[model samples]
Target: MVAQLMRSELPVLIEHFHLPTLPIDPDDVAFILCADNGKATHLVSYDNHLLELDDRYQFRICRTVEFLQDPRVSQAR
Candidate 1:
């Protein structure tokens, strides 16, 4: 599946946005920024800080399993 995705046209390269002053962990900022700048619908992770920020950002923050179980994700598949 990974190889197939790599060969497919679903992957995109996006530029990193400037850091924001978030209350969560500093190291997790890049993930949030990437999702925001890329206009992603979800940001999947297992980090407690990121999960705690579920409703704060434009994108939905969730665990990997939750993301996989999402109806939208299933529909995409």
Candidate 2:
């Protein structure tokens, strides 16, 4: 995956964020946006910033407490 990510030109964008480079590849912002558009899975986030993306991404803006009590999460176990 590191090789693939390197080839995808993601390292440059990651560097722009001033984040330290790591061995493992992190998911790209564009990929996350595409995933939301495709309705691939639930986008779980407690951050207020995620609310701004809700309209565009069709993501569920859940609180930390609500996420913890969601039955689907428990069922996966």
Candidate 3:
């Protein structure tokens, strides 16, 4: 899967990003920043802190299952 992703055009490799100070966990900030910088429609994760920030960010935060079940995600495939 890693090799496939590396060769695919679907991924955007973020080389430089300005880290923002958020109220959430330090380790999770990178994930949020990546999603935000990538202009993602959905931020998928099982972390409770991220899930709780669902309506706060530019992107929609959801669980892995919820993301998989989203109609938009399926339509994008």
Candidate 4:
């Protein structure tokens, strides 16, 4: 699956950011975090470690349920 994905035009997940500092080794955490930071948007995740990055990154971190319902969330179009 990874090889097939790499061969496509879609961005490979791990290439999204520098992952050397990740705490739990889950690529999803880094992927979502970097995307939000790059876009200046909120990060919605179930991971507790990720939720703790709000103060450091100037972005909101919320559970997926809360993020989807927040009035501030705007689709990127």
lDDT of each: 0.79, 0.51, 0.79, 0.62
Best by TM-score: 1
Model 1 lDDT, full chain set: 0.79
* 3 versus 4: better lDDT goes to: 3
Root mean square deviation (Cα) for candidate 2: 9.2
Model 3 accuracy (lDDT, Cα):
0.79
For 16-50, candidate 4 gives per-residue lDDT tens digits of 44432354546556555575558756777777777
TM-score of each model, in listed order? 0.68, 0.35, 0.66, 0.45
User: Would you list the clashing residue pairs of candidate 3?
Assistant: none
- Give me the overall lDDT of model 2: 0.51
Per-residue alpha-carbon lDDT of candidate 2 for residues 3-37, written as tens digits (9 for 90 to 100) = 88888987455444322222133444544455555
Backbone clashes in candidate 2 total 0
Give each prediction's root-mean-square deviation over alpha carbons: 9.6, 9.2, 8.8, 6.4
Model 3 Cα lDDT, one tens digit per residue, 1-77: 87888788585554544643363676787888889889999998888988888888777899888888989999999
Which 10 consecutive residues of model 1 have the lowest summed lDDT? 12-21
Model 1 steric clash total: 0
Model 2: per-residue Cα lDDT at residue 31: 43
**Cα deviation of 55, candidate 3, in Å:** 0.5
